[model samples]
Target chain A: MPLSTVLTLHATTDTTLPNTMGHLAHAAFLALLDAAAPEVAEAVHGKGENKPFAVSPLTVHREPCPVGREGDTRGASRTAGRGRSVHGSRFTVHDRAVALAAGQECRLRISFLDDALFRPFSEAILTLGQPTIRLGKAELLIARVTCVGSDEEPEARYETYEQLVNRLPCTVDRAPCTAYREPCDADAHSVHGSRSTVHEQLSFRFTSPTAFRVRMAGGERVNWPLPDPVRCVRSWVRRWNEFSGFPFEEDELCAKVEGGVGLARHDLRTRMLEFPRGRELGFVGEVDWHLTKHALADEPFLRQLHTLARFAFYCGTGIKTAMGMGTTVCRAP
Target chain B: MPLSTVLTLHATTDTTLPNTMGHLAHAAFLALLDAAAPEVAEAVHGKGENKPFAVSPLTVHREPCPVGREGDTRGASRTAGRGRSVHGSRFTVHDRAVALAAGQECRLRISFLDDALFRPFSEAILTLGQPTIRLGKAELLIARVTCVGSDEEPEARYETYEQLVNRLPCTVDRAPCTAYREPCDADAHSVHGSRSTVHEQLSFRFTSPTAFRVRMAGGERVNWPLPDPVRCVRSWVRRWNEFSGFPFEEDELCAKVEGGVGLARHDLRTRMLEFPRGRELGFVGEVDWHLTKHALADEPFLRQLHTLARFAFYCGTGIKTAMGMGTTVCRAP
Candidate 1:
């Protein structure tokens, strides 16, 4: 089972951190693992390939969120460690350098792709008396961690493929404020519609810039900054096969996906993320991946595609997930 | 020279027309040509392969533009048939069925790729007395046809590759409101920067939805809607080679464009145009195509690509230029 855990920290003093903080957030995650289990940390850090975990950039709010609260007052769930704390500030990286004043609250979300790494991460923070992470030159003290949603800030997410595949049709029993939100703090895929529903058309919102690596004419590799159905599904399937233990027929799956899925509608725009190598261009916004008339005949592939759409919530889309690109959300509309 | 000619027409009576009017616009163009030169019209209509002309849909405005006015009040240029007539109105096809009231003004733009076709089109419209075209059940009376700039409506456009490539760097003396606009009415590629300057990067604004026909996995044909630099340039090069009469090595040009040109920045969004076949999805907005590090060493290809970038203005990008899709405007930043 995978988990998306969020750590709420308070800045000790005024400091400014670079906008490209995803790289630093990953380092903080490893530091946490290193403190609990150095061996596991070594393996995770050394495996430059797809590690079992990913991290989001440090999201800061000038106005603080309730960090030391025990539980949400609404009693949404037992796992929601902190009560209904909504950080309504802009999560967008607006500047090259972001300023954090003293006592300002910030959040760092870590997603454990595999269960093997979750134990150490859970132990690392739980056992530590006073844990702090260095951001820029300031030491930010970890006040609390949340794994479930409060009523006001419903960010809790934890579900397996079985749970996703067998989930019931919803909307009647969901939170009233189920306004479309990016699962920034939790690992929830936020899947709508039930497993039994004839799921043909699905939409995805690329919360972060997402791009696909395409091999163009003459064997030149280039970045395709578009939400292509085949490429997006292929990227998700790669991770699913690697970690899920249920490997898919890559060639056949790709063929069906390529022929069946069509971009029925979209509202996408290109965005550039400044990476160390250079600027990486990608697209962010909603894309409606629709199954064509031919695809309706193939029932199994349709089920598989829909399942992968939910899985994309946990795995993200395209490459550079560790560096804060490809944060996607799926919905039925 | 390729010319972008816009005809302002007044509706004879109130009537409704379908939003997908590009096909009808093309037919009206052929009808006008048949009235003037049936033999030329026969060759053009028969050569369905790369008809020497393309057309935009009938753009309607409830509030009439000054149609019968002699010249645009701007007094911008001599060749301008009507002086500055700026259609500040939203040119978007808002609804599936658009209603045109009696005496409502509408504009139709036609691009003549080859000089051979421009003669018949020009003669057909200029020589006719009280030229009128039918839209749905309404006959639209041609009020004015402007090929040069008026003071207010700067829609007059006429440029050649030599003119674009040899034009000097501008901005010192230009229209105060040369605010990057989509050249909807004219065949102006709108190239900036002189050939002597190092034109490493250029930008394009796709006013109409543009899509590329790509061969996907297992030899499947799919539509990729984002503006990939190589694909856009290749699309332009195809039309350039077909009509420009100065053909370059296709494979070499594609290779250079693929390996050299990179999408550095963009602000694009997807929109759907309802087509008879189905809904055709493509993207609209701006893209900055920059030269890569390796491209700096290749001067000839660099110069060649910059030329194509300007040519992209007249030829458009991707498939279905004969329809109203792929209306592009180029600029320097």
Candidate 2:
């Protein structure tokens, strides 16, 4: 059961919501999961084990922000206030009144690394229509479930990343999608080998502001201003190998990026991102980058590398993918 | 080995060429094949055998035609004369000098059912760049090869046509894509079995004018202006079974369409198509039809039927898929 599912929620009431809606959206996604498969949700977000899913930030579809900083800020707002009647979890937006209009829409997509959960999730989504949900001050009415699909199966081994990206849906912009790496503790045990023949180009468009989290020497978690490419790639590879039902170990292959052929970020700027839970101040920003000549040292791991890379496009990369962070669009070159 | 290849040819000449360019494209395509695999071409088109491929008519990208038909005709003219030097087969545009201008492009896509041939064909295409080739009076310099890929492997059984179509590339438009069958001879052997639970809706945009060739009572082949729904579905099913490397027959199944359900052609008109060999004055025309509830009698055949319908999209239906005919865009519902 090798599959990747994407669900498109078309908002009937407001689509012009602020980018910070990721928090509210993430709460609703969990509620939906709990409604569909409480056990599965418990297994994913419950108290001890690791999760097998990633949720993208709310991808808003609307006109560009108003001209000046003041004007743009006026068009989108966030406030802090508790819900009158809470179920499961309560999310509140403080004082911000600006939101998506009646006819506008936005998208909240989640990828299940575990294919076994697809059916329950799909069934739950199909039953959700016109659910009155509040993001902040605005109440949203979902018009329809526009699109839901599993990703195509991975292609033949030795296939280039440039050739694989075009086949995946929701990919935006052009090729050369890349993630930056500056070393991290999660991968403290990671070994960086020299390059191999997996020379391919990839492009990613950070549709929403994305952030990464890493632990400091004192065991305190902190957001990394710049994403660590090696850790990002490792997560995707590890998740895919475990849930794809065709498991492989990192120890079986040598994976590394050729030195000096570094990642190039383009046309991006940052925004201070806040969510409903108010646990931390996250960041969101637009990003476009290119990754070329990223190689896996072992010849036998070529197919596994390609499969994991392709999965990265759907499941996204970085921490809190399930909480609306790390949403990306990697186009095939 | 389940993959579909789409070749996007960026023309270094005018992009607004007429639909008739399919002739010149066919000539060049055969030449490319001859260069890559002469023996394969001979086996496909040579001797007396059914060709196992389909060639779509040249898909041109251009500014809309001029206001007056006469003005458009004046802008592009067709003059008849023999090729100064002929090779394999000669193709002439007949005094037509108004070809695609530089900086514009056209697409010539071909689908091969033989998975074994993908490698050699892919290699041959990658090596072609800036090849100065004459397509009658129009000389085209292929600026770049934009995209090339093989179709994804068929999804697991019990998959819906909707699911399968989305997994394959080259599908456009909305769902519930279908074809209308008004009744035809090829379907004479087609038993209109009573309906079962195999309900589905499909939409197909015949990018090229699609025609069907079926044998009459006397065993003579005739062209079908209107496609036979039963035969169309059957062909897709048969072809998919053969190429998917999974063999299954519907010996215990009966299939039928719901009453009053029919096909609707959108923005379509007919044209008398001619080829270089002058074997026959073939008719080709644009087709956009939606097929629904085209169900199979048995529940078990549902998966097989879905698989075949998806194959129809890549392999196409009817004859001469390899010579620029039967181009299609079948979208899932």
Candidate 3:
């Protein structure tokens, strides 16, 4: 048979008791549980249609309320008049499989209840006592609840763990599961699928006083012994549908500077240096990655590509990051 | 004596009436004489200290102003009363060399004065008329004046050649001189003194997929391939100090892209390209020229440098103009 665990219903806040547990105490309890048991955290916090709790999974059993003994009415009346109860609810550990592992004791020894059960109760009396249970049983110990408390400290009043659990409208099984994991560190190698390839280049030009002329194919030309710095930047872009390997081959980008002296020439030189080598530079040195349409159909590949594009946009001009200095000038070609 | 030449000043605006020749008549007469007899465009529109009566150095002289009889009260009274100027103030060409160049029968005519002189005056007139004299003889010829007119018509005004020249203060002798020269057309060889040398270089980087590692003197380090396109631009700047050879030793004076990638890797590649010289992968080209410092310190050189710098800056950054892009980073270094 599956292990049955006790679910404790303890009153965290008691206005009647000075310096006792309060709302902060209850919040701390949840935070501690989350830190200690990530699995429990995941089970409680999992996103779904119904989110009951933000803790891990467990088969919870609530403790039963103690019955009044015969001829004990007078004692009960006296306690009831004082707004306190002597005989409180008691839970027993009957399932050996659910017992805590050795050396894995609860450090805070705190109690937890479904928020839905506690949220409706105005006042309650909480009694935390050692559980009466058999060793090696499949049961695990949890807190018990007693009588209802005064109106002045309504939230402090408590009900039996059984009563609280039974009052809940939804089954524990219906609660969404939380699968928490450790935070990712920056050093981990990024996982890039086969669909994407990253390309990078660095080019340089030198000034010569004696050169006659420099020429490139397709009528591109640069006169030697350049009078001033001439920087040319260009790129090509293609829509996702029209992406082809030869997209950048259709046109060339070109820029030239003439006039004035000194600062103007220097400005021209610097302008060329920062000009985007792709579309921004009139499609001068553009290359198409030629991303296949099939790749886009894959969700993960598409997601990764989008992520990379976002990263590039954030980086801007490339100098700020390890990406160096460059321009973004391509779509899938 | 240096050869003398005759100059002519033609009024671009019409001012052929009399009586309009008031206080300005004498000044205008002096201006015409200075422009014509010397055949100098001094004080010509947009030239030297441009004055009232101005002439174009390129304009050919046809007829000289007629010399009026001394104390010719009849014509003076007629001009003063009618407020119309016929012939403006004029002077004879006394220099024998200039007279002989005009030929025995040739009369030097003044034409083309800027239009600015007539705008302020209501009526413009030439007092003296048909005053002619033989060559090599100095004689007073024309007189003119201006007055307020009753008509409310808007006056036509424009910058006169004399006014333009006058506005440009003479600083050729006082301003610091430099040996700069403007760059000729692409086909023309740039002329430089013995002190000038030119430097240039060209470089390329393998940006496709494989060249992601940077090997330096310290160690081989893998670099994250840039996710964006990269471009390389080159620029040249002039240095002012005199040096025995090239001032390459002055690191600050050298225009360069630095810090993004370390120099060790760049230096190694440069050496490989220089040594045993053959084709090599990951090899880009570079050129450098050294010019005499004095040669770079001229207006033409400065102008060319400014133009080049502008081009470089534009191309490097892919910006259309210098206005919108943030402050330029190009400097003397």
Q: Compare the candidates by DockQ and give the number of the best one.
A: 1
Ranking by DockQ: 1, 3, 2
The TM-score between candidate 1 and the true structure equals 0.78
Tens-digit lDDT track of model 2 for A19-134: 35656665666667778888976766672222466665543333332221212222222211221111112122211333544544444455655655666776676776645455
- Expressed as tens digits, the lDDT of each residue in B1-333 for candidate 3 is 001113222232212222111112223433444434323323233342212222111111223323321222333233333321111221111101122111111222222232333322111223224322211132322222112112321111222222222322122111221111111112111211222222111112211111112232223222211111111221122111111112222233222222111110011111011012221111111112212233233334333332332222211221101111110112111
TM-score of chain B of each: 0.79, 0.62, 0.18
CAPRI class of candidate 3: incorrect
Q: Which of the two candidates, 2 or 3, achieves a greater lDDT against the reference?
A: 2
Give the CA lDDT, 0 to 100, for residue A57 in model 3. 14
Writing each residue's lDDT as its tens digit, candidate 1 over B62-147 gives 34445543322221122122211122353444225566656667777777778888888778778998889986576889887877
Interface RMSD for model 2 amounts to 30.6
- Chain B TM-score against the true chain B, candidate 1: 0.79
Q: State the displacement of the C-alpha of residue B171, model 2, in Å, after optimal TM-score superposition.
A: 69
Give the per-residue lDDT digits (tens) of candidate 1, residues A1-333.
Answer: 546667888877666667566666777778888999999999988875466766655566534445543222222111122212112343544224566656667777666678889899889988888988885576788887888757633444666756654554422222222111111222133434342344446778787777787654345455667787888888888877877776778779888887777665566666666665766667777776656546645666766676678777777888777767777778752
Chain A TM-score for each of the predictions: 0.80, 0.62, 0.15
Is model 1 an incorrect, acceptable, medium or high docking prediction?
A: incorrect
Alpha-carbon interface RMSD of model 3?
A: 20.7
Q: Model 2: residues >4 Å from true position, as ranges? A: A1-19, A47-50, A63-98, A127-137, A147-199, A251-255, A258-261, A264-269, A276-298, B1-333
Error of 3 at A324 (Å): 22
Top-lDDT structure, candidate number: 1
